[model samples]
Target chain A: EDQVTQSPEALRLQEGESSSLNCSYTVSGLRGLFWYRQDPGKGPEFLFTLYSAGEEKEKERLKATLTKKESFLHITAPKPEDSATYLCAVQAGGSGTYKYIFGTGTRLKVLA
Target chain B: NAGVTQTPKFRILKIGQSMTLQCTQDMNHNYMYWYRQDPGMGLKLIYYSVGAGITDKGEVPNGYNVSRSTTEDFPLRLELAAPSQTSVYFCASRRGGTTDTQYFGPGTRLTVL
Candidate 1:
């Protein structure tokens, strides 16, 4: 079976605070790992896609890094606008379809 | 491109009623997917299609049916709505072959009574 777990279900940070969200997974085979940001009453927005271990991708103040068993999304000097639900997903080697197994998500709130 | 779009942004249905949530993409992606988001549980895949005329179930497909008749549209059908079925449905699509980015629609908020 495949499973994904995210730590620190809820986080509150000061405007200049820096922290990282964790996504741990156990999959049969890993094809790709994805990071997304979702706001209330809206759909998720794609952020990064890391394919292999030791791979990292960044966008603005957000950075994503992936290892064999887990992935981390690091936010540097976050702002109030960066407050949203951060989602983590993994695509496992499937028969044919690319079904993503998602984590419960980490709710981030940055106070200005 | 408009990315992915879903119709009936919000809906309310009585038990046993049926509804179809429409999703379309202008990106010409070959893959489409349907998922439901619940409070605190994250997102669960309902169904997916690799291309036109091919559809398959995901982890939670018991009360859902999907059809991909064209490369641009994939709609999810709820044959019998129930209170437990109340959720926010999302549709996503992406380019085929090694494409990891799946663009999502705004989502449909469904309330079953």
Candidate 2:
């Protein structure tokens, strides 16, 4: 079975504090890993996509790194505006289908 | 371009009532999907279509139906609404497969009574 597990269900950080969220997965072949940020009462916004192990991508204050078995979303000096639920998803190859298995997500709060 | 638009931002439905949630994208994406998000739960796929005339069930397909008669429109139908169906529904589109970044709508908040 292919599944994703995210840790630290919730986190609170002071403004300017940096942190990292973990997303681990168990799958046969990883085609891609996706990161999304979702605000309250809104749909998720696409963040980054890591295609292979040791791959990394960054946007503004967010950086995403991927490995064979796990992925990390590192927030650098986060601001209150960056507070939101972060979602991680994985797509496995050879499924002969197009579907993504998503993690439960980590709720992040940046207190000002 | 109205990337992906969903109708009825909020809706309240009584048990056993049926409704259709409309979704349309102007990006000419070949893939469209419907997902329901429960509190604290990740978005679960309800249905997806690769292109016109091709629809398939996803992770949670029961109580839902969909049609893709054109590249720009994909609507999700709920027959016999239930309290268990109360959730925020999101419609998304991508140029292709899961590897592609999906653009999502604002989402529709549905409450079942």
Candidate 3:
């Protein structure tokens, strides 16, 4: 079965603190891994997509790195505005359909 | 561009009732999808459409139906609302490609009694 798991269900950090959220997966064949940020009562916003092991992508203060079995979303000196639920999803290669397996997500709160 | 947009930002439906959640995208995307998010849970795929006249099921498709009669719109239909169906529904779209990032709408919060 294909599954995605995200650790540290919830995290509270002081402003300017740095931390990393983890997303691990077990699938038949890895096609793509995606990261999204969702705010309260709003839809998710796309953040990054990691296609292969050793692949990394960055934007502003966020960086995402991928491995064979997992992915990491590293926040660099995060600010309060960076607080949001970070979601991880994986697309399996053999699934004919473009379905994605998603992790429950990591809720991040940065207190100023 | 309006990106992806869903109507009825919030709605309440009694048991056994039915409703349709409307979604439209102006980006001329070739793919559209519907998902439901429960409290503290990741979004579950309900249905998806690759293009007009083409629709398919996703991880969670029970109690829901979708149709794609045009490239710009994809709507989700709930035939009989149930308490278990109460959730935040999101609609997303992307240009047809494996690596294309999905663009999501403002989501609709639905509650069932």
* Alpha carbon deviation, residue A10, candidate 2 (Å): 0.5
- Per-residue lDDT of candidate 3, residues B36-106 (tens digit): 99987899999998889999988789999999999999999999899999999999998977666888999
Model 3 RMSD, rounded to 1 decimal: 1.1
Off by over 4 Å in 2: none
For model 2, residues A1-102, the per-residue Cα lDDT tens digits are: 989999889999999999999999998788888999999999989999999999999999999999889999999999999989999988786744577788
Compute the lDDT of residue A87 as modeled in candidate 1. 95
lDDT of 1 at A23: 98
Put down candidate 1 lDDT per residue, A1-112, tens digits, no spaces.
Answer: 8999998899999999999999999998899999999999999999999999999998899999999999999999999999999999988876666778899999999999
How many steric overlaps does candidate 2 have?
0
Give the TM-score of chain A, superposed on the true chain A, for all candidates in the order listed.
Answer: 0.97, 0.96, 0.97
lDDT of 2 at B56: 92
Q: Candidate 3: where are CA atoms >4 Å away?
A: none
For the record, the alpha-carbon RMSD of candidate 2 to the native fold, in angstroms, is: 1.2
Q: In candidate 2, what are the lDDT values of residues B67-108, reduced to their tens digit? A: 999999999999999999999999999998547888899999
DockQ of each: 0.81, 0.71, 0.75
Give the alpha carbon lDDT tens digit for every residue of A1-112 in model 3: 8999999999999999999999999987888899999999999999999999999999999999999999999999999999899999998865445777889999999999
Each candidate structure's TM-score, on Cα atoms with residue i matched to residue i, is: 0.97, 0.97, 0.97
